[model samples]
Target: MYYGKIIGGVLGLLVLGPIGLILGLIVGHLFDNGLMQTLKFASPQNIARIKQSFFETTFLLSGYLAKADGHISRQEVDHTEAVIAQMGLNAEQRKRAIELFKRGSAADFQPEPAISAFMEICRGQRQLCQTLLFFLISLALADHKIEAAERQALQRLATGLGFNAAQLEQMLRMAQAQGHFHGSSGFEAQPGTRLEDAYTALGVDPDVDDKTLKRAYRKLMSENHPDKLIARGVPEDMIKLATERSQEIQAAYEMIKKSRE
Candidate 1:
């Protein structure tokens, strides 16, 4: 008799082993031909693969975005290096990231395949997708303003990844206010931060109620949580961005609370 759960071929021996078990995490499959799906689990190898894919895509996309404006300015190059330093990537990883960036910056570089592959391997995780987009946007705005070419490139990339115009605009505003990408939606505890920028970060209007405000803050925090991303196969080394972002979000919320009181 075929059991409902995963079972061996009569003698109760499993052939697929870890591969079958890990498939459940990425694909959530079920066999119809009297065979059971592999026991549900996410393998360590799968986690590593997911992280690597994210790392590669982010590096390449960063280059592509930078070059969208006819030439990458010296300031933009410095900004890229600053971000790399902020990520705290190791020597070998940094070298590989640089290589990927160069390839994407080529005059005839193609972005569709890279975007498609990124979406596929990401398993449709919206937060990861948002995070990746967030990083690219931050890089684009690093020179204090986004040129026409940069905006068009971002819009195309955003649309290709299933995000609409509204979401992209909202993200750009929040990323600019926060000055970094960690998934949070608020500004840092910097001096003279305008209340309007705080509202923009949390993506709420001035007329929003306290209840709605808090909810938005909580949602952003959860989505941008470093531990949450790490648990879902994001590279451990990249957690620093989220960590710093958490601090900024907290600061923004605190500032909002003070104004309300």
Candidate 2:
């Protein structure tokens, strides 16, 4: 009888190899629930920690970016609040975000722990990480300007999230090409004529004179320069976009110069 049963089991395995494997897996999982849980889902404590860390890191970084241009304008604060509201964070999360923002605005904003935690969270959920970055980009441009230091900091965060240079550059280009200049709206101007629009994209006045234009261009270039952007966490792919924007600005300046002449 034993021999017969063994023979029958071998026959079943041969007849249903995949099904047998699946069943074996299910039985094994049942027997090793602890291992399975550890491998698949984060512990409750870890989940809470991750959520807290994400909120803190995001708020801190956003605050840092807001203050990068010497002062955090009311517009920036309002924009950040809007972002916070949109995130649909719970009371605890909202409170944590505020605390982080306060810490981030301090004279010494050390981003290492936040960055590390962000990376860990991103490793587990890439989509969430991307979403967080998208929010940061929006925050950086909230005041219609991207400061050099702010851009640098953003790029650094992107890189720390494991985005390669090429990937970062691509994302930046997509962001620019999408004409996110005035938030998430589409392109609002045509080519060439977009010179003034480009200035607007950089949050500058279209009628700026040569001296001011040059100064603004220099300031923007200093921040968005490919190398500096790369150093700051801009993905390599998005660096090209920043380069293109810089070129557009130069072109606009030249056009304005010719018009003045």
TM-score of each: 0.81, 0.51
lDDT (10s digit) by residue, model 1, range 1-261? 234223323222344556655553233223423233112214566667779888998888889989998899887799789778988888998999899999889999888899898887767678888878887886897788999999999998898778999999999988777653223344445665687767877788878999999999999899878878886766777777676666667777776888999
lDDT values for all models: 0.76, 0.61
Candidate 2 structure quality by residue, lDDT tens digits, 30-129? 5466555554445555555555555567788887767766788898889877766765667986787788887887768866667786776535355446
After superposing candidate 1, which stretches have Cα over 4 Å from the reference? 1-41, 180-188
Winning model by TM-score: 1
